[model samples]
Target: MLIKFDVTNEEGDRLKMQYGQKVASKAFKMAALDAFDLYHKNQELHEVIDSQRTEIRRLRNIIEQARSSAAQLLEKTGQGDLIDG
Candidate 1:
């Protein structure tokens, strides 16, 4: 009996496993579990990246508001609008 298994790694390279005489089901199951773990870790990384992006955007908005308010306060106080000074 001959069995051919198609497996691919992170680099998208196809890995071929041949079972000529006997195959262990446990080994195959372990490989599948490892692949699942890799997928789960990738998902977690994507979530972290999304959270950081949201935080960056929130901080940028706050900075913009602070700059605008500072300009308005300077104008109201007749501080000569020293934007660069």
Candidate 2:
């Protein structure tokens, strides 16, 4: 996920004074780069999570189908009451 970092003019001036111009600028650059890296990592993690969810859903569907087939077979053999369906 993308994150926004904004600083107003007064904030910028304060930061510049607290830390010299070079240090302040370097800090800002590093922070921005770190944010970008975090966003990229977050995106990759989300993709993996989504893929896992899809796989889980697919597996659930297969399980439901198997249960349904089993129930049908049991019914044909006059053992339908054996299932808790």
Candidate 3:
């Protein structure tokens, strides 16, 4: 009974192994799971960062508009000259 299996490494190297060989399939599975978990975590973090960036931009626009409106109000109320000095 010859059972052949192929093991691939991160660099895409294929290693041929026979059945009943001392291979760490459990360890490989664990590493794969860890990598998948990290990938998902990074994706979530990126989404959160992107959302915060968008919110920050929106808030900055609102603040700029408010500042412009306040400056206009000051000018209309004759307080612009005081601020200019």
Off by over 4 Å in 3: 1-30
Candidate 1 C-alpha lDDT tens digits along 12-82? 22211422213444445545667889899999999999999999999999999998998889889888548
Of models 1 and 2, which has the larger lDDT?
A: 2
- State how far residue 32 of model 2 sits from its true place (Å): 1.9
Q: Can you list the residue pairs that collide in candidate 2?
A: none
Give candidate 3's TM-score: 0.62
Q: For residues 4-64, what per-residue lDDT tens digits would candidate 3 score against the true structure?
A: 3365563222211322224446444445557888899999999999999999999999999
Model 2 TM-score, all chains together: 0.60
Give lDDT tens digits, candidate 2, residues 1-85: 5445587867766666754664556556555667888899999999999999999999999999998999889989998788766
Ordered list by lDDT, greatest first: 2, 3, 1
lDDT leader:
2
Candidates 1 and 3, the one with greater TM-score: 3
TM-score, candidate number 1: 0.60
